[model samples]
Target: MNEIWIEKYRPRSLKDVVGQKDIVDRLQSYVTAKNLPHLMFAGPAGTGKTTSAIALARELYADSWKGNFNELNASDERGIDVVRGKIKEFARTAPIGGADFKIIFLDEADALTSDAQAALRRTMERYSRTCRFILSCNFSSRIIEPIQSRCAVFRFRPLRPEDIKKNLGQIAAAEMLSIEDDALDALVHVSQGDMRKAVNSLQVAASLGEKITVELVYHTTGMARPEEVKQLLEVALSGEFIAARNRLDDIMISYGLSGEDILKQIHRTVFELDIPDYEKVRLVDRTGEIEFRIVEGSNERIQLESLLAYLALVGENRADSAD
Candidate 1:
């Protein structure tokens, strides 16, 4: 529904799209002139590329925007037929309310195959005067060279931590939620520079009531509690191989901590440990190899156990060398 936080909080205009100043500036130029070129918006997920494209349409057409905009997802529709048919239907119709050209927004355009993209290139050229295409994708490299050449490419960067915090604060105030500074920081860290995720997390936390804490976000993201993960690492570093393996099994069973996630926590915890530089480097290298092997279809529990064994050895080695 339109009342959903993500949709409800969607930016209505260029200024509302956060953390993309340069892209906004270039897009503003097109809106000001009322004559936009074909555009390719490339960026990571939830970073406002689709939202910016919609905002641009809203600005350019004002009240008549709906009639002048056509939005489609290349990945959802599949193949070139749908794209060609939609482009023909939309481009054939003149801009509503006497506007010079209509706008077609293609989300996830990079999903189209090379052959489909070639067909899209022809359609783009044919409709250049009557319709402007705004293509959105996670990666620009996947788009065919010919289509990329025809469009003005705007790269959207992930929102910075400060930007995420600022926007989250605004949303929190609007929703009448009280939050602590540390909790907010935790949300930002988990979001990893994604404003949409931050907002969504805040909305979920707000829905539960006023007392939102960092642990709430940690649970929301399905990550094992930091304390629990820390405990597992500490036990492993104690050099009691059997006890360490038992603790790992308990963690995996109780909290569903996957091999990949355990590896990430181990990576983070390694830096915080009092180990020497060379030893830290060696541990990290081994951790990386285990991570890669886990990803490459090695049994998760087996690979992780092997990793824990290595950690135990390293901890014992370090303790002995220190002695």
Candidate 2:
């Protein structure tokens, strides 16, 4: 069976991990000292929180990494029971290879309930001698201050475009895939600094054919082409409300995109529009309102059409002022 490229190409060592240079350097220091405090990795998704935890364990434990490291997703069982049961059991165990302490990596730790986090904080305090905890969460604020104070916090930043491109380029060369330059750009744009998304999109595109094009990247990823999104906005900005609505319908149906997806694309395309900054700001503000309405269960089609109408109004006012 062909392995998932994300897993196949995951950075095995701190040196192999891309981006988060500061975090990686700090982790290396802990490994050099063979000592670790309870750690909290706070960051956005796919920014190497989990990967960094796993890599730290491997470096610290070497051949015994698997035996000493326990991985759990707090989101799966976010109640106090897990903290009292499985976690307590594992945390009290002695390291198998004479290591100072075992590591427990809790992913999505912010998902834990108040009671569970309270229990977890106590557990970390009690297990400091026998085990160390690495907690990963998208939002550190959701974690109780007590737990936050107990751990050395590392904040990870989103990957840069060049970093993502370099990693993808290496993966492509290794996989012997031929990808067009525009296809690579499409992947980067679609990924929005998420390495996992970028790699998975590339893998999906590669499966469809040997040579990946812009169309393949966008089609496989279920994203409308940027140019198409820009065209929709341009049509609306020219006061062609009906024409813009028709184009909007085409883009949504063609990509099977959700209302939020189309709205997000439109929002991104707005700043790039040739209109003045004030118009762009108004369009962006209106897009946010439409997005909020859609998220609140408003009818997507009506909400989207209303946005196009507003765009037409903005366009008309701009023309009148020019005259």
Q: Among these predicted structures, which one has the highest TM-score?
A: 2
Question: Residue 237: error of model 2 in Å?
Answer: 0.8
Candidate 1 residue pairs that clash: none
TM-scores of all models?
0.90, 0.98
| CA deviation > 4 Å runs, candidate 2 | none
Residue pairs whose backbone atoms clash in candidate 2: none
Please write out the lDDT profile of model 2 over residues 181-286, one tens digit for every residue: 8988999999998899999999999998888899999989999999999999889889999999999989999899999988889888888888888878888889
For model 1, the stretches where C-alpha displacement exceeds 4 angstroms are 225-231, 234-255, 264-281
lDDT over C-alpha atoms for residue 33 of model 1: 90
Tens digits of per-residue lDDT for model 1, 19-53? 99988988899888989789999988889988999
State each model's CA lDDT, in order: 0.84, 0.93
